[model samples]
Target: MLMIKSWIYCCLLTLPPILGLSQNLKQEVEKRIKAEEMPAIALEILATHLSQASKIRYYKETDIGHQSFECKFILDRLWYSVEFDENGAIEDVEIKMDFEQIPQAALDKIRYSLSAYDRYRIRRTQRQYTLAFLSSDDLLTMVIKGADELELRYEIVLSVKKDGSWTTYEMLFDQSGLLIEKKEVVDRQTDNILYQ
Candidate 1:
């Protein structure tokens, strides 16, 4: 019994952190809000493209000790998600896109990378724009002009089979399908009231 107890203790100690739990909070609520409630910087950047946008919705993400804002809208029939830091600086802009939209070379690379897994299913894909130190005016111009000059990256979510188990992971890849970051999707927290 002692040996069994020792094994259980080891297993519990080495367990990985919960997949979906952010480092900042046990739970996070992404609540939608009015555009007017957002900071001036974020609004100004958004205003440049408002002429062609539809169904614009703003959301504020508040974790225990972190805050960020996001605006999602449809532009020219394409879905766009723009995230801003607390200071209203553009963090990243994501455009929902089809998997086939990836360039041939990048698609090939992504397939090769996925080959390591036993099996995988692509869930979603997005084209992400991240410009470094770009002025609001430049961003406004670039966004309004369809982002043709920007180097966009692909963000993909997939359910992958590894070691005979299925796990969901969010992966970021450059235009060339080079791996940038991989994070496992965590499950949502259970309600304590139900258990109690």
Candidate 2:
């Protein structure tokens, strides 16, 4: 009887987080922060590449259960963002892109992938770079220099009209326009996947 009681107690103790997991899965929050608030390593990495960068902004972002820091700026008239994990390890870099930026074949594939929706209105498009098989420095270099490499992927935000209702979604497509992940936005009005 005591053993059964202890097992029940253990399950009850862990039940809260499991129950909260569903509520937490799609939650994301963004807050503007000062440069000094960024991790030292992230700041050092940014300083190396932000020589002529302008309009730089620092943001602390929380997604699901993970926290990250991002530095966004305009470099050569293009918006760029560098994200670092809570531990100060570089995560990825993103650059704003346009429909025309996607390769012709890839765009066709991307369109085909979205054909199921009645219509998908694009809200935002960006090229994401991560240190997949390369070092962070190398990945950052690829991002700044516009070098299309292995770690490149496209992150797109779209509003889809399906079943006569509009729903916002954030989609990630690989460099070849293959669908990676599609996450539905909880609330579009105040949601911030990437800064506007």
The TM-score obtained by model 1 is 0.77
Best by lDDT: 2
- Which regions of candidate 1 are displaced past 4 Å? 1-29, 63-65, 187-196
What digit string (tens of lDDT, one per residue) describes model 2 on residues 1-196?
9999999999998998978644646677899999899998788778878889999999999986699999999998999988899867779988898977798988999999999999999999998888888776667777788775466789999999999999989999998899999999765454465665
Q: Which clashing pairs does model 1 show?
A: 19-186, 20-186
Candidates in order have lDDT scores of: 0.84, 0.86
Candidate RMSDs in Å, in order, are 6.5, 7.1
Which lDDT value does model 2 have at 114? 94
